[model samples]
Target: MAESIPSDSPAVADDHHGHEEPSFWSKYVFSTDHKMIAMQYMFTGMAMAVIGGFMAYAFRMQLAFPGIEVPGFGIVTPANYNALVTNHGAIMIFWVAMPVLIAAFGNYLIPLMCGCDDMVFPKLNRLSYQIFLLSAVVLLSSFFVEGGGFGGAWTAYPPLSAKAEYSLTPLGSSIWLGAVALEFVAFLLGGINFITTAMNSRAPGMKLYDIPIVIWMIVIASILFLVSVGPLIAGAIMLLFDQQLGTAFFDPARGGDPVLWQHLFWFFGHPEVYVVLLPALGITAEIITVFARKKLFGYKTVLHTTIATGVLSFTVWAHHQFISGVDPRMAHVFTLTTLLISVPIAEMMFVYIATLYGGSIRLTTPMLWGLSFIAEFLIGGVTGIFLGASGADIYFHDTYFVLAHFHYTFFPIAIIGTFAGLTFWFPKMFGRMMNDRLGKIHFWGTIIPFNFIFIPLFVLGMGGQHRRIFDYSYFPELSMPWMQDIRVLATSSLLIMLGFQVVFFYNFIVSLRSGEKASKNPWKSNTLEWTADSPPPHGNWKELPTVYRGPYEYSVPGRDEDYWPQDQPN
Candidate 1:
């Protein structure tokens, strides 16, 4: 057998020397153990996902039934509806997706995958999760405050988000800003840990190439976030001052430029898209190659293109500002950059396709989600080109088209990518196999309903139905009977999608206790995490693993087994 991760490796031995078993609270609640902390991130993100999903259901009901009473929540007032919209976007991206995708998996997998015992800054890692949890609680608490959650949308644009009078939220706006500022701080701290650990803590033989694609992508994402998020942090502070202290940094009435905030926000905002996206792509990459039983085609090419994509993301933020009255020349420049950014992304897609061609494909549950991500993300990416052209954006901006574009992009990134990673890593994380049959059922239910909900928005958007309103009853031309039909269909599909997740959640909970116990190398792959115990040990390995080859070394000629592990001493 080609076994690799030792149960008694020297490095693990050295690190755990004189290590004591943690008490229950220390182990589960406040431990510096990366694995335990990962569970914390996962559980918290899942909780927030429920909150964000309910907000979506609330607004979708409003859209479909038009002033119909939402069941748990009363009739969605215009402000309440807007609050749902704003908080849904903000919570999913900041609280749910960022933590699940970046913090949860990044902390869990990076140390193990990089052959390190723990993050370089273990205390800081715990602090990041603490801050992240606090951010979530603070934002959720905004719902009960004097005015209700801030309705200014996630962007928190200047004029509306500037003054509570326009927004109708005295305390909500500042609380929202405070919550988001805390989120930025958490990610900044976590990003430092991710980058430092990857650079300095790899095992002796694990070269840059030997590092798995997922770890590399996470490191790149951390760097991208660190560089891109600074201006937004500063901008958020200015917005805070403008809101509470009446400083008017973004208030045009007080000699502040509203457009300046847009510039600062989108500058970070654009890169922020890829900060989550690169990890999604990376997770999908790992799953695809593993299930297909093939070496990742163009691994180095994907890496270089990822770097190129990060660089290009900075230049394209103005695409979101087309209607903000940017000069025509700058619009032209942004349009070109926006379109150019797709090339690298498209090239990476080609690499994924090439990786699967002529290989034995598995189509497992994780594979299903990975494949869905490629197909759906492509649809989302392609539709974005129309909006990227500044001329077309004049027509499409803020319409259902833009809403559709983002949901297609981010829904796949946030939902599908997370689903794929969750399914892929379930065995390693929990020491058991999730129900594959149930997993496939969840996959179909999710992807089909997902497409049904958003695909029609392209039609509605091109037809010129605007987004973010409580009702379109007055827009007779736009609110045709067919419009209601599609709205009903989309809303119904969303409900169906939510229903499917019930299966996943049930399976997840039950399987944790009773699922088939997994072996150390369940999928029989080469990654170091697999070489550890199925759920891994406190320190991940008994001794640090010495990597002998690249991550994804599968199907060498004359090899008896189909998979070639990196630590396999041939």
Candidate 2:
């Protein structure tokens, strides 16, 4: 149950009653505090990112310099190369990106932004992380199983993934399926808490519109995840039964349908894109409005468009099925909806651009990342049109063009957008300022090399370079000696971008102990969380903040200060 704040206490003051301070274990580990849990998610996700990043490095090294001995892994074999590719895609999406972007901020920000003490189901929230941690362990263990890690692509398409006889790695495949299933369970539990907290536990007198757009996005995303994940979970279970117990749900020899698995996987898979994307969009929206010193343009329209996008996401999963032997007529339907889905996204992007027009812009570290997300995601969204159309997709189907498009989308949202939120809320999270100068340096280092790495993939893709091929030198048709330079270039850009993150991590850690102490509401933005202590107390507020207006009030005429906090009396 949500705690009731006493009537007489102010929002910012502490110490209504005396209580002993908890030990480190109780306060930090095994705690139900949302902020602590969020921190746990961030660190754990970063650890997973290290694992995922290494996999990408190994495979990229293999492609750029085939059979070269890496320091730890030795010369990358064909089987080993496949593992790196499969685990890189799987770990980055499921373990690193989703947990960091969705579960991390969803736990940390939802209650605070919605004006609550902690999640309504605090124990369930804690268990979700514990389960997620176990899932990570299980996934890592698959690397050691019999024939090496399962590598039927991240899509895990069957007959290849379904039959151990065909895939030739029985135990690893089964465990991978199990890990993915466990992850789904963890998020499902977390998603329920998000929706319930936003709906039932909002601070009194705060109407739906008074809620921050970030909170709205998280709630809607949770709903989409909950509704969409069911089929995939069912699909995974059936696949597991086939692999371990020989049920043959996807094996055609046993009268099962391989295309059925694609439908199930992609049904959840398409909305799953927004599951990872919308919260980052929420973070960028908040940062942009604050830095630009303006109200969010078309707040109601943005809200409605968000819901529309969620609905539209469901209809376009079959776009992935166009070349997969589906009915061409049905292909036309999916293509139409896939292209149409971009309209709402384009509207939201233009709104951000319009919000920045003639406003007092702060070129802060966070704003740079927010702007990078817009710029990068625009490229991603535009390129997706080519793949959305059946005619164009048949040419670009499994090429690096698709790879470039998705990396543009997921990297910006998960990496760039997450960076923005991390920097913008660093003070709020830690009660200290991150070094703004170092942050700007880190931002440039990441964005420039990121573009260098992925943009050339478009050219290589246009040159008919296919994805997941370990060596291209064997083929005479692809044997342009100069084309290998593109592979080397992308690999070099990856290493450089990774080097910058060391600076980011250093700034994040050092600033915690030695940086400038923050005042309450450092950004002076209009949000209830800003009404509390910088690192809010265990229960977040001494008294709940009563709402007065929307969260984006800025630059109004006759206001002495440009900002008006949401807790201030109107």
Candidate 3:
């Protein structure tokens, strides 16, 4: 049974509990609270995931069994494959991962963990979400427009994307350009909010050192988005001008270089991967500390490594353009920077694994996701080394090997890390604990099938199959019996992977209403948010927590409990 406090209690006051109920607009439509904004991001991201996943499946079907007609959905054509690939990349990266990891988790967790009442600028946060929603609507609406959405690619490479003559749809390319601009603006707004809130809103005594690793990652990611996104925004504007205003920024025939677009795009693109990885890194830090029953080892080293990773991310953008006929000298430079990136990443990984040495390990759902992240991310990161080598990249650049490597990296962060954050914070988010049994089922099912889906993709790449092709069976080089057998197996694994998500969906929705009530500090960790109410009030903490130490001070020798909240005075 749960105990209740009076409305006039100091706890209520400290938590900013004045309103009995919000009116129509405040409650849902234009909520200013960080938590509500996070929920809005989650729902929107999930919707985009469905759209992106369906697009992937559609393309996959065409690749495995070409010219096969299924009920309700019509035949998948070559042009349709192009469209699916474009929309899939755009939706997954920009809409699903960016919004879910950075916007949603960053917004919700930052204020709560830092002991702040709201984002530094609440109304601005609301506006950012609305703008993102508007951007998604505009993007989806493009599919219904003349010639459908932009089919060139999500990167919208020039010559391909700059001319209406080269594009399949006149309106599709324009809408793609416009929709992306809107989404960029949305992120810009969000980036400002994240940086400002992290810097300005931390509770008294909560120095930068005392903040949680998750906040640090988010703050760094925000800075990355701020500095890195500007070039892409400039490039997007130039591409739009070339497409619409008779300019020649990327139109080679009109005195522009097609390769220039790749430079501008990948300049932002590689850092974008770190933008996704950082939040996952933050969640990993939090979970590893709690589950290991120990403080994070080499905390400052991990922080500096993340900062170094961000700085090095800018220097390695040309690696993606190695085959695009850019300066060969630049390739060696990029190769060095790209490989150097792994050192910092490896340092961080070693820290997590070292933290787990000889500690009490509880195989909770969040910890399971964290451990799985290490395994899956390692496979992804190690394989990335293969691509970083210009010699090896020559054969594998556009091959399924590259696809497998990135998918390995992305799935763990986007799927596993997101699930880890969800499982770890579900109690605080919803005021109820998710069913442990159901959570375990969701975890194992996903981890097994996820590996199944991508591991064979490596084989496909090794067999000389290229990515973005509609049909594998059409090419005799790829039509060998062994290749065909593996294609079928891989396709089956993908379907199983798709089915496994249903268990997660069921657990998430059902547990919201019926799961066990959670304690305020369910995980017994030394984070500020845990010191507050279970489902923290509008402001967050009852009395604003005055931090006394770093966030990961678990198992301190003299402490009565294994962990201590940051707010507890000596």
lDDT by residue for model 3 (1-570), tens: 012544344212122334567887887878878889998998899899988988877777766677887334579877777888988888888899999999999988988888888886666788899999999999998888878778897878888898878877788888877888898899888889888888877888988888798999999988888888888898999988988898998877768888888888998999999998999999999998998888999789889999999999888889999999988888899899999999999999999899998678999999999999998999999999999999899999989999899999998888788999999999988889988888898888888878877899899998879988887767899978887777777777777878878988898888898888999989988888787787887777557778889998888898689987888896
Error of 3 at 448 (Å): 1.0
Give the higher-lDDT candidate: 1 or 3: 1
- TM-score for all models, in order of appearance: 0.97, 0.96, 0.95
What is candidate 1's lDDT per residue for 169-225, written digit by digit as tens?
A: 989999999999999999998999899888988877889988899998999999999
Residue 371 local lDDT, model 3: 92
Deviation of model 1 at 219, angstroms: 0.8
Each model's total of backbone clashes = 4, 0, 1
Q: Which stretches of candidate 3 lie over 4 Å from their true place?
A: 1-20
Each prediction's Cα RMSD? 4.3, 3.9, 5.0
Off by over 4 Å in 1: 1-18
The models' CA-based lDDT, in order, is 0.89, 0.88, 0.86
Instruction: For residues 130-164, write the lDDT of model 2, one tens digit per residue.
Output: 89999999999999978989888889999999888
Give the TM-score (vs. native) of candidate 2.
0.96
